[model samples]
Target chain A: MVEAFAVASGKGGTGKTTSTLALGMALAEEYDVTVVDADTGMANLLFHAGLADVETTLHDVLVEGGAPVEAATYERFGMRVVPCGTSLAAFEAAEPERLRAVVADLAADADVLLLDSPATLGSKSAILPIVLADRVVIVLQATIPAVSDGLKVQEYALSYGTDVAGTIFNRVRGDVESAAEKADRYFEGPLLATVPESEAAQQARAAGRPLLAHAPDSEAATAYRAAAARLDPRDGDSGDVADRFRSAVVPDPP
Target chain B: MIPEGELLRSRVVTDLATALEDVLDRHLDGYAVLAPRETLLGAADGRGVLTFEDGVPACAYHVETDRGGPAALGDVGAGPYRFELYALEAAALEIAHDADELRVPPGMPAERLAGDPALATRTRRRAGVDADRPDDGGALEAFLEDEATVERIRESARREARRRAEEWGLGDALADRPDG
Candidate 1:
């Protein structure tokens, strides 16, 4: 039973790409995971995957419709990354519905797919994954504006009918939980999980490596791993939070 | 009581905006911190937006290297800022990887939420299409609706926050606190 999760942000820089690879990696540990760079406008998940020879890409499926999902897939780091080829123009020009059809074909190749998207639903075609994704995981910042944008995106997705699995509080620090809470309240689902703010992610993005792989033991890395646990297909306790915190996340899967 | 993790994170963002505001006050009349509709429009407004998902605070330089040529999103300035904000997209990856403990505050009012049953049904239908033949057009229409809603709600949120602060004293004591 494969599941498709669309990783879209109301804005960029919400740790969408990094989370995609990390989650895919974590899931790959148990399930066959595939990460697709839906950011055809700026397809860079390959950079996050730390793979340079992304000779084959998502464009083949969208434009040429040449390869089946497996052909467009790149198995790396023990996972498959369906890179958004280097052609932004092609992706932008491709029809939104056609792209969705292509991705659907592509999703068939993997048990779990992470569709990485760009910020803003600017291009109607660009957002195919948001509403179509089996689980829409909205990424949020801890700021009033960031939270607001996230809430709006989630609300909109829900309104238009997207299964907003939950909110991902990224780049959070000492006080973001409240901001995230406000967002969770208005959003149609739970604020499910959060990622502690860390410099490690910046370092990883620059170095082109997953934080877990590069700084495996860093607090940020551990936090990333914990976040992955919450997204797991399995339902149970991760035992990483305060007892009260544990109960807060487990019972509510919005 | 501050929920330092959440409050501090929000404070830092406000702090960043204030810092930007100072720059704007001293340099420009009104500068917008262009971000996706998903970005907190509560900050200064800007038509040109950048991805700021990281929670750590750092000043990025607007390094204009090329026009219609290759340009990299560059950070040119460095300062002793208090905190940082992670790019939300990247955070999603970390969460998926089970890297960090993406904890929602124990204080979030989850009980107050109202799930949009439509979302689940739509997702189910898409899931069916996803498994076989996903209608890309349908997805696109849906995505547009979501995106449009994101921008609209962001606007509503900005107004709401302002209302709360002005009428409800949300930022009453914090006004005296060293926000930036």
Candidate 2:
């Protein structure tokens, strides 16, 4: 069985890449998780996953007549990671439509697919992960603009018929219980977990490792594990998921 | 209601912390009006009034929502705002400051409105606050309570999504595509 999730936040500075890797690591304990850096334009999952020095990435697989998807895939931190190159030239050369095929290929081999999506909904390419995913897990910071942006992304995902898996309130300080409780009312899913602001999370990024690997004892890591527990990836026929991805209509480049 | 004060400085500022810091540095006794030219939430007419005691925020109010204190801070949207700082006498602000409903924690404005935690800590220190008072999230709670604003955001996003779907050739995937 396989389920694809687009881990998205409408705007940046919400620790989305970190959350993606953290969730992937936590979920990998019980399932075969394939994490893809679907944010081709601003990919940082490589840095967070310690795959920054990999020779091939999603970008290499996305170019016309490019490398096979398997060539870009790596086994890292107990999961399969498809990192994206941080080169402007690679991003410019890569065709966004090829992502559907790549995700379809990965879906066949994994129990769960987590797309580390772009932080914006401005471009078709950026919104593609949300469009293709079975559900979206919105990452949020407890601030006005962050929540507002999260709400907007949720609407876009719902409009395209993607389910709201849940929301993770990241980098939280002080009491956000009341706010998160109230905000949960507007969301279709529960408040999965509130990840506290942690120096370890920042240090993990600097060390080029997932937070679970770098500091499993940290509160943030504990919260991530709880989030993964709450996710409860639904049973989906891998063949059906793969076929859906393969059959998905590719949008025109913006 | 706050008594009118002498105009000290007025300018459009994108960052709210800078204006707050200026007031703190000058140790000004007065109030400031923050009127966003356009809010991120699409509410342009809403404005926040923050009164300062020795440059530390003492009370707050939002003109459009008729909300005061922490809730008013929630009403203050992300800025590129017309910030009008005025100088007022301490005694003149005494009545408004004494209104419990309008009083805000000294650092609440910095933390909630500016999204700057460090600035909040500093402001708390400057105001002689104990620093352990947990933020009740009154501002965000208030923001969530504003159903009209939230609905506007959702409605706008829905329209944008539909329009973008057509533009990007993803109209077939929309939940309610007419042709489908």
**Candidate with best lDDT:** 2
Query: Tens digits of per-residue lDDT for model 1 on A1-254?
Result: 45677777766667888877877776788787778787776777877776656566666665454556567777678887777666667565443434555555555555676788777754444544654565677886553334545665654455334466677777654443443544455565566567776778878877878777767787766766666676755322222111211121111000
lDDT of each: 0.48, 0.88
Candidate 1 CAPRI category = incorrect
Chain B, model 1, TM-score against the native? 0.20
lDDT of 2 by residue, A15-133 (tens): 99999999999999999999999999888999998888889988999999899999999999999999999999988889888889889989999999999999999988889889889
TM-score of the second chain, cand. 2: 0.80
Candidate 1: tens digits of C-alpha lDDT, residues B1-180: 011121213122322334332322232211123233233334322122122122211112122321110011111111112332222334333322231222211111000110112222232232232322211111111222334444555556444433433442223211221211
In model 2, residue pairs whose N, Cα or C atoms come closer than 3 Å (at least 3 residues apart or on different chains), thus clashing, are none
- Evaluate model 1: give its lDDT: 0.48
Candidate 2 wrong stretches, greater than 4 Å: A247-254, B1-32, B35-45, B52-56, B77-95, B130-134, B177-180
TM-score per candidate, in order? 0.55, 0.88
